[model samples]
Target: MRKVIGIGETVLDIIFKDNQPVGAVPGGSVFNAMISLGRCGVASTMLTDTGRDRIGDQVVSFLSDNGVCADYVQRFAHGQSPVSLAFLDEANNAQYMFYRDCKVDRQDINIPDLHADDIVLIGSYYALDPAVRQQVVALLDQARAAGAIIYYDINFRPSHRTDVMKVTPNLLDNLDYADIVRGSVDDFEVLYRKQDPETIYKAEISFYCKRFICTRGAQPAVVLADGGVVGEYPVDTTDTVSTIGAGDNFNAGFIYGLLRQGITRDHLDRGLTQQQWDGLIADALAFAAESCKSIYNYISVDFGNNKQLPNHI
Candidate 1:
């Protein structure tokens, strides 16, 4: 079976409602997606590091519990495991504050050997951080050499806004190497000072990567692809208990859609028909909608066990 591999950070999210911390869960951008894929019966593996503390133990154990392979996780004792404070507002959107204690010297993780049709996930500050850039780039190189698909989620959080200029080169390198790029409007706004999907794709993304997906909070998502094809799809606006990890699960569902459709590198390069894109978008929305119904960072186990492809899709 083809596998999905993710390289990113691992943090314990402390979700706060009003002024009190109510729950804690393990999450990272790609980590959250991997967990969902694992639950959905996909082969999921992750490359990340955390301190050898109780928090890190919980993270590793959580991955195993969720069916994600944790063999490549590096546990060091240089510092404490990362923690994130996510404060919820009136609308259940989170305001985040992160605490990470990692040294520049301790991020040595082995790049996975790749195979054709495998999917590699990479993005966020972890992929751009110079400390891990060489390893991340090496993995990307291997993925390309092995004919694997590279999915880049530009999950640029507000915390890294100040470093946008400094990391532009890294960001562009990632975009150039990606087969598909997904980002929220907020991410592009922070990276390029642009919001319109068409404008952002034409000005910033199309040159480096043509398949660009732009999402806005609770709004329709816009997809721009090769050959001047443009698609704007309605999103699920069902009542959300918490908006955390909604995007991650969307990525998972999209990947699952790709797998279920047997859309490989050849199909992507040739271009997907509008109906194919609709199926993918529907799958993405379904996963995201299911995730929003709870506080968990991934789809509920029951939901995962019973997930069905959108009827029309």
Candidate 2:
């Protein structure tokens, strides 16, 4: 069976609203997307690290409950699991503060077996961190050899701005390995000081990857310069309860669309038809909007139960 593999960090998100504690959920960039895929009954597995403590137990349990395979997670004995405190504002967007043990590398991540047409998701500072670069690259190389489609999400935040010069090479390397690259407007602003999706794509993203997608919060997502295709796809607007997993679930929906539409490694090189792009982006918009309507980092259980989309692959 085809599967989706994700490599990233895992954090317990302690949410606060108006300075008061609200809820806590397991979250990370790729981790959030994998969870959503699992909820949708997509074959999903995660490669991450957590402490061998109660928080680690909770994290593993959450993954299993949501249907993600947690066998590849490395439970370290030396440090505590990471945690983040997210404070939501009036607009329902969050400002985050994280707590973690500073470490050089996590070495024991067993790369999951990859097969042709499988999808591998990777992003965030985890993709650029020098400490774990070797392990990440090992998996990337395996996926490449197996003809898996690698999807890169440049989930760069302002917190990583100081390392821009240092990690530019790693960023470019990831772009080179990626079959599809997605980034938010905020991510681009921090990387290139550019706001317009078209400008950023033409200047920064095109040389490394042929497919680039740029998203703006509540604004139409730009499918920029992808195999001579350029269009603005509008978002599904809704009264957002939280914007935590909007982007992550957008990714989940996109991958789900690929599986359902039978898009494979073969189709990526030949380029997708206009109709295929429509199906992918529509699923992306709908999943993102659905995730925004709730506080959970992944799509609500209710949404997954009624999603009705079948994974043909």
Candidate 3:
């Protein structure tokens, strides 16, 4: 069976609405996606670290409950589990304030066995953190050598603007390792000061990676591959309770689509037909839309349990 392997950080998110705390959930860039994929009955594994604390225990339990393998999660005696205070604005978008107890020894986890056609998901500051970048690069290299399809998500945030110059090389390296790159318009705007998908793709992305997915919140997501825009697919505009994990679930949905369509490392290099891309994007959009209906950091278990794969695939 094809598996999805995600490498990133894990955090507990305490969400607030109108200055009042509403809900708390386990979350992380890749963790959110892995949880959704696990619930979707996809074989998923997470490579990350957490403190040997109550929060870490909850995180581990959450992953297991969601059906994600927790064997690769590193638990350290030093430091404390990270947490983020997410304040939801009137638009239902999140503004985050993170609290972390990071130690020098970060990302102390073993790389699981990767096989051909496995999808490797990685990104965010975790991939660029100097303390862990070498390990991340080595893992990426091994996965690529093993014929895995690597998906990179440039989940850059405004808070990292100051480090953009310092991390440019690392970002480029990740782009070079990726078979497909996914990012929101806001991520590109923060990284390159450009919001136009075409300009960003041609000037910043094309030289490194051939496939780029640019998502605009609540707007049609643009797909660029082999040099230019292949097509734009409309997003489902549901009543968004919170946009915290919308993009993460979209990534999971896209990976699910790839598995459903029988896309593998071979198909990634050969590229997909227009029809295939459309079906995949539609699947992704549906997941994102469904996630927006709740404040949870991932797709609800019920949604994933009952979710149907795109018929065209």
Candidate 4:
């Protein structure tokens, strides 16, 4: 089996409601997806940095317990692990406040060898950070050269919106390297000032990557692929406990479809048929919907274990 390799930040998220701390969970954009994928028995590994502190210890243990390899994680002795406070509102949407003790970089550990069938998934500010971008780009370049699919998720938040000009080049560069790109309506609006997801896909993203997924919360996601245009599965909006990791798990499920379909890296941009894309997007919708129903950052056991994912999705 070809392994999935992910590189990103790892942080502990303390969730709050009504100004009081409710729960804390270890999470990051790519971290959440990789964990969910590992739980589903995918061969996965994460490359990230964390402080050599108790929180960092727990983060490492969490990865190991979930079947995600922590061998590539770097531990810095000078700082404490990063943390985020996510405040949930009446709609269960999160507004976040983060804290991190920035530390000097250490040489990254050796990346795992990639096979033609492998997939490399990465995104968020970690991939775009100046200090880390070179290493990340090198990994993506190597993966692409080896015929491994590179998936990029633009999970840009409001905090970065003001720095659009500064990060636009990096964002486009990352897009240029990916075989598939996924982003939400807000991500594009903040970066491209385009609120229409389909327009963002066709006008901005499709020029770089042939496959684009544009997600509109509650509304149908749009899939623009080589074969044709396909609208995504419509999810029923139910009560959500917290919306922290829904998108990350959606990425995981879409990746699951790719793996389950036996898609290889070389065939990434050209392989899937319309029907295949539909099925894949459906799986992603189910995963995202399942996540919205819980306080946890990923799909619950009942949904994860159900063989009815396709039908329900």
Candidate 5:
């Protein structure tokens, strides 16, 4: 079976709601997705770094418990592992405050030899950080050379806007390396000061990536594929706990669709018909919705139970 290789940060999330501590879980954009995929019986490996502290040990144990391979996770001795305090609002959406110490140097990542149809998922600050951009690009180049499918998630946080200009080149370079590019309305707005997904696609992002997925909260997610005509999938909303890692799990489901249908680099851009696209995105939406229903950072059991879609092409 082809594997999923994820490169990103790993942190412990301590959530608080209504002045009460609610739940805690290990999370990172790519890390969360990798866990979901691992649980689905996908061969998943995470390349990241954590401290040698208690939180770091928990992160390693958590990944192993979820069936994620942690052989590539570098353990540092100097600092404590990163942590995020997520405070939930009335809408159950999380606002995060982060604490970090040791900034990992990417020279330590052990990049495994990849196979032709393997999928590499990378995103967030981990993909765009100046210190690590060269290493990230190099890995993507290797993955592309090996004919692996590269999926990039532009999970740009608002706090990083101050450095947007400084990081634009690296960000675009990462997009160029991607076979499928996924982002959110907020991501584009923070990076380009643009709220319109269509406008961002037409003006800035479409040329760099042929398959573009733009997700808007509580609204229809947009897809711009071969020939640049637009398509959409509306979200199925429900009563929620918190919106943490929703997009991450969406990537998991999307990649799951691609894998289940046996999509590979040779046909990754072969333009699925409307029905096919709907089938794949249905899984994506379901996984994302399931993540929102809990305080945990990944998919719930209910989502895993209903994985099949009968009408897919």
Candidate 6:
């Protein structure tokens, strides 16, 4: 079976509502997706770094409990693990305040051996950070050479808006490496100052990648493919408890759908049929919907264990 390899940051998220702490979970843009995939019984690995402190211990333990391989995780002895305070608004959306300790050496880990058709999920500021750019690019190069499907999520946050110009080159570099580019309206608004899906796709994304997925919170997700194929899938309605990892879980669901349907890097160049695209998008929406009903950062363990892809695909 092809595995999912996620390269990103890992931080412990302290979720708060109404000025009180509600829950805490290990989360990162790609880490949440990997954990969800692992819970769904997919073979997954996380490539990240953490300190040797208690928070790091919790992070490593969480990954192991979720079935994500921790072999590639670099444990640094000199720094403290990062933490993020996630304050949920009335709309269930999150605003974050991060606490981190810097180390001169970061993301110092051996890139695991990748095989053809393996899915590589990478994004967030971790991929754009100047400190780790060379290593990230090297891994992407190797994955591309191995015929792995590379998915890039532009999880840009408003906090980094000031450095958008400095990060734009790295962002474009990641786009060049991606087979599928997934970004939200907020991410584009911060990166390109554009929110319209078609405009963003045609003017910015299409030049670097041929396949694009634009997600709008509580709205429909728009998918654009080669040859002018465009598809839209509406988000499922749910009584959302917290929207922390909704997008990450959606990514997990789409990747899970791809694996279930046996879609691979070899088939990507040919593009997916309308049915295939719809099925994938629907699965993504389902996962996202399921996650929003809880305060946890990923799909509940029970849901992931019992979730099944549609039989038609």
Q: Which residues of candidate 4, in runs, are more than 4 Å off? A: 301-313
TM-score of 4: 0.93
- Candidate 1: RMSD to truth: 2.6
lDDT of 5 by residue, 23-55 (tens): 888999999999888777678899888889899
What's the TM-score of every candidate structure?
0.96, 0.97, 0.96, 0.93, 0.94, 0.97
lDDT of 3 by residue, 90-198 (tens): 9999999999875536754688888898999998888888878877987898898999999998999898899999998899999999999999999988988899899
Off by over 4 Å in 6: 227-229, 308-313
Better of 2 and 5 by TM-score: 2
Instruction: Compare candidates 3 and 4 on TM-score and give the better one.
Output: 3
Q: Candidate 3: lDDT of 66?
A: 87
Better of 1 and 5 by TM-score: 1
Worst 10 residues of 2 by lDDT: 304-313
Report residue 131 deviation for candidate 6 (angstroms).
Answer: 1.2
Inter-residue clash pairs, candidate 6:
none
Give per-candidate clash totals: 0, 0, 0, 0, 0, 0
- Where is model 5 more than 4 Å wrong at Cα? 102-107, 305-313
Q: Kindly indicate the candidate among 3 and 4 with the higher lDDT.
A: 3
* lDDT (Cα, 0-100) at 255 in candidate 4: 87
lDDT tens digits by residue: candidate 2, 1-313? 7899999999999999999989998899899999888888888999999988998999999999999999999998788899999999999999999899886247667987899999999999999999889988988999999999999999998988899999999999999999999999999999999989878888898988989889899899988646454678987668998998888888988998888888997898888888888899998888888888878888878777776356556
